[model samples]
Target: MSKKGFAGFDPEGLERAAEAVRELSQSPHAQSVIQLQIRQQEAKSEEAKALQKERELKKITHDHEERRKTLQKNLEINKETADYNDKLERKRHTDKLKLQDEFQEQQRKKQEESIKREEKLKRETMEHQLKIEEKRLLIKGKVDAEMYRKNHDLHKQELLMREAERRETYKQIFQLNFNQLSLGFEYLMNNPSFMYKFFLYTASITTAFYFSRHSIQLGKNILFLRIETNLQKKLYIFLGSRYLESVIGKPSLIRETSKLSYKQFYKFPLKFYKQVTQNEQILKKNIFQNIILAPELKDNLQIISHALINKKKHQAPLRNLLFYGPPGTGKTLFAQQLAHSSGLDFAIMTGSDIAPLGSQGVHELNKVFDWANKSSNGILLFIDEADAFFRKRENWNSIEKSYGRSRYKLT
Candidate 1:
């Protein structure tokens, strides 16, 4: 009825779906419906026209009731077609609204899922951070505890060691004092009832020691028991005779004696006597002790001791060794005693003495070595903690070489 001759609410639908839909509107099936609808509409229009024509005809010639009945039927058919079109339009609108509702529901569900995912991620992140923080705190606490424990242990060990050291020091001092007292007592007891003679001998010794300490070199001359025993006996006899003269008016049997009778008598060499006495005491005091294996070593010590004491030997050993070990094992004292007993003319140096010497010190060292070499081939030169200066020379830098200096020509 319109442009394409189709009967529908939307004639444009046929053109939009397919070009052939226009032809379908002209097909026998759709055309039949269209023709019916068109016929109905045309009938209504024709019926109106007919009714008017009939009115005029009736006015001209009587008989228009049949034509009015026909007009009413055609109007009824037009109303039926209008009702069907209205139903089709309502169905299309309902379907479109249902599709829109479904889409909105899907969008809302998607948004909810997104929100849930974001919240979950936030929770997980917070939990992870909390765990890490806890672990960090735990590790820090452990480290602190371990450090405290170690420091406590170290402090305890230091306290015990200090206590032990103090006790040992007091013990050594007591032993030394005891030994000196015993020696003094034995000296008093051995003098055979000659009180004045003993007193004089003690006085001479006391005076000699006093002068020696004050460094009156000439007055400091002191003697040990190294002379013959028979000669010492005669000197004691002469002393007894003098005391008897003062007390008993010189026994008549007493006579003039040879000057040789007054030479100092020695029961045994001071070296052997002192050594035996020292060994017995050392064994009694120290639970553990060190021993040198060479019998010749003791003789060597004795020879050197006498020579130095009497100024009979001025030369010193050119080669020496310093034995190093743990504390209470006797390092310094052993060296001092060996020097004293052996009578070696020697100098002692410690690690602390290496500094303080100026740049010319190296030359002085050379002179010292040369002089010692001239002094004697047996001269011993030893420095404790020599490893400080004699480090490995791999770097070869000036500072390192200078500070860590060592001379290997120590023959």
Candidate 2:
């Protein structure tokens, strides 16, 4: 009761405050404030969403830039690597070219050196051969000179001996004549009748001398003719003249006998005719069997005969024989008989005949061998007086002192 009386204090203030809260809750201005607050909260949420979207876009751009930088770095590294590889390839190519050039140069130098060495060796060999040839020529010249000198001396000696023989013959003839004249004078003095007898004797002697000389000459001529006839017949048989005539329809020119005498055919020595005639006579007589020989000589002959007969079958070697003995040992006879019995052609030549020919002697000797080879039958060459020509070369005197003399003699 007193609440209204105290300075207007209301005893229902708590209830009135509650009633005011209920009225404010129903007011339009309060509802408007609540809606504005809700709108502000939605705006804040949208702004946060936009900021998140912006951060995502920025992260994408940053990632793209980093990827681009990495790509550019890779491109630079690849280009640098390519450049290094190209340089390396070029260096290798240049080194190969250099090596190839060096190898080729070395080969070329080796070939040139080899050629030079070969040339040098060839030159040395040729020079050595030339020197040997020169020495041989010098030796040959010396030998020729010595031979010429020896031959000249032999010829000179022969000439001197011949002159001496002629002189001796003339002396003997004159001495005989003088002695006969002296005896005639002595006989005339002893007896006057002896003068007439002496005249008759002289006439008889002169007549006898003339007839004897004529008879001897005639006999020689007859013997020579006989030998010539026999030689012609032998040549006709040996040369097969009948066969040759049949083929040629005429006589062979070689078969025609020469009418020339010894004097006309002076080139052939008289000994050549004598040897030919002697050989013919020995063959005709068949004297080999009649003649006696030493046991060794007979055995040698038998051996030679057997060898000759079996030569073609056995291929036996033929050796040269040397017969040295005193004169008249029947060496020539045996050789001729051997040739005849063996069916071999024989050529006889004397060393004296060869000496006169000088250098032509060698040529004639060669011709003899060549002709012998051409014969269908084998040939036996008999060189008489071989010792006169085939003396030891060591025994020959030097040619220096006798050069001019030898030259004159040769000419």
Clashes of each: 18, 0
Number of the top-ranking candidate, with lDDT as the measure: 2
TM-score of 1: 0.22
Candidate 1, 1-411: lDDT as tens digits: 445544535666666668766767778798787788799999999999999998898775544555666677778777777788788888888988888999999999999999999999999999999999999999999998999897998889999998898688668866876787687668768755665676677567555444432332222222223354466765665555444322212112122211101121222234344444453333323312354425675466445444444443465533345465665655555555544444343444543343334354465565445444443312334455555445445532443445545433332
TM-score of every model? 0.22, 0.29
Estimate, for each residue in 1-411, the C-alpha lDDT of model 2 and write its tens digit: 435636887757767778976886888686777678778888988898898889889989999999999999999999999999999999999999999999999999999999999999999999999999999999999999989887998889999998898677668756765676677578788898878885677566555544543454465456556654687665555355333322222111111111212223332334343333343332433535655778988777668765654566699875577878887888877777666655465666666555555457676676555555555557667777786568555532332224446768989
lDDT, candidate 1, at 45: 96
Q: Measured by TM-score, how close is model 2 to the native structure? A: 0.29
Q: Write down the RMSD of candidate 1 (Cα, Å).
A: 35.2
The C-alpha lDDT values of all candidates are 0.54, 0.64
Candidate 2 residues lying further than 4 Å off, grouped into runs, are 1-39, 141-411
Give the per-residue Cα lDDT of candidate 2 at 295.
91
Number of the top-ranking candidate, with TM-score as the measure: 2
